[model samples]
Target: MSTPKMFNHKTQLILVALATVLITVFTLHANGYLRHSSEQDALYISEFSLIASVPGAQGLVSTKPADFIARCDGGYLVMDAAEKVSKNLTGVLVDQKNRLISCR
Candidate 1:
């Protein structure tokens, strides 16, 4: 009896291409290259860690102070290594600019 072919050559090629794409994507995502680093000049404020509460603005901590350029309803806020955010005291990241810039 002849064995039945599970998939045609074209189907196999398409499946292999899809698998290759998936693997590449997963590998890229696994590596940190897929994400924007906080060291970059334009950083998302959500990456900041809330350490203390201060008067006027809430305290936030970041690895690199110079990269703390985040935009809110008011404008872009520049923070030192130790800084505070004037608005959205509860949210983790920038209010409207929560979408992060993909590194790759």
Candidate 2:
């Protein structure tokens, strides 16, 4: 009777390395750390403006609003001249902007 050969040392090492790599990839993908830069679904843009606070504001308030404008990783498109992006709005800022501008 011939005895069956178990996984040799080299085979065992290779299997362990492969498992480690696969597990690492799976974990990164699951946690959203392995996303591609071209994925537009991850892009988010919001409009923020400074509002002057009242003298008698209850919470922490400042009299002078900052003049700095926040810039993100995209080109500028003036809302007035910019065409309608599409009927299918899928993001929070996009939907809110549409609703606010739409005369309903």
Candidate 3:
């Protein structure tokens, strides 16, 4: 007796086509040819500490003048002042072209 064929010619062709498509996709991904969303620039800050005294100033203080200077220089600064005052103190200094000038 002869052995029966497990898959016919048409079924084998279909499987070959599907495998080809999968292989193409895998190859593209391996070669970094797949499209992806652009990533945003990341900002880095240095470590430093400063103290400031404001005369005739009332209410609260957000960030120290030194910390403000650091922030302007592309460095991150944290102030121990109240949140409200800190929010007010937070401001970005930009150039005429609207570009950040506080980069060290």
Candidate 4:
């Protein structure tokens, strides 16, 4: 690295600005801004569990080896399955980015 005496005003300002932006991004990520919250994760898990319990229901999207999600848009598709004693869904929720959001 160059000596402090060799650093000019423009170079110092650029370095300071870059450092500030990096620190801001790090702080936000530390507060859970970079990933989904636990609540969203649980909602998706619950829905996947419900669908998996169905007799013949299948998952349309696999986010993990042990988890899958059934995406719902709308169509005249009729799926058959046993009468679940504790599972009912009226609609699918999506995020602003058009990805599978969750039912919470």
Candidate 5:
């Protein structure tokens, strides 16, 4: 039988740090401090949160994951899947609080 190998101090420290980061991420997610990709796709403006607002940009997918936007740089950043789009957005507007106002 082969003897069990022991990890060195540096390896052990690295492993510990990784574990800590994983645990922290899990805790944040469980506590609702982090939002899922679908939740992030939702556009919630104060004035439009209750009303039937305009939909996402045309030619974009209408699925939960395919259509998502993040407010950035004076506009609602179009999100494709979980990424922000940086091109060819026709008319997207955002407020100071980074809420989506309109997209056409």
Candidate 6:
């Protein structure tokens, strides 16, 4: 003869509670509602200036915002408002006379 296995009531309640909490946490995280502070720090643009230029840049021949684009010496330039260009800028189209132009 074999005996049937059974879960104790307290154990069952604990398991249910744990599952509920886990599901709630998972749901919140999936929806971007719950995130660790460290995760927020990861939300960074590789190129601050390039990201800023997306909406402001019109076209290759089109003119850029005068305030955003500046003239350094020989050519035109695009500067980052956040002033985080050195490390963040991915690529440079032209670097003339300390001016930054073109970004990808």
On TM-score, the stronger of 4 and 5 is 5
Off by over 4 Å in 3: 38-104
lDDT tens per residue, model 3, 1-104: 99999999999999999999999999999999986653321222223333356687554545655333333333533223235334344444444464554454
What is the TM-score of each predicted model, taking all chains together? 0.38, 0.35, 0.36, 0.34, 0.37, 0.36
lDDT of 6 by residue, 1-104 (tens): 88876888899999999999999999999999986775434444333233345776764543644223333433544333334344333222343353456433
Pull out the clashing pairs in model 4. none
- Candidate 4: residue 52 lDDT (0-100): 60
After superposition, the stretches of candidate 6 with alpha carbons farther than 4 Å from their true spots are 1-5, 39-86, 89-104
lDDT of 5 at 68: 39
Best by TM-score: 1
User: In model 5, which runs have C-alpha deviations exceeding 4 angstroms?
Assistant: 1-5, 39-104
Query: Where does candidate 4 have its weakest 10-residue lDDT segment?
Result: 77-86
Worst 10 residues of 6 by lDDT: 87-96
lDDT of 1 by residue, 5-38 (tens): 9999999999999999999988998985587545
Indicate the TM-score of model 4. 0.34
RMSD per candidate (Å) reads 12.2, 11.6, 11.7, 12.3, 14.6, 13.5
Candidate 3's displacement at residue 28, Å, is 0.6
Query: Model 5, poorest ten-residue lDDT window?
Result: 43-52
Show the colliding residue pairs in model 5. none
- If both were scored by lDDT, which would come out higher, candidate 1 or candidate 6? 1
Q: Estimate the overall C-alpha local distance difference test score of candidate 4.
A: 0.52
lDDT of each: 0.54, 0.53, 0.54, 0.52, 0.56, 0.53
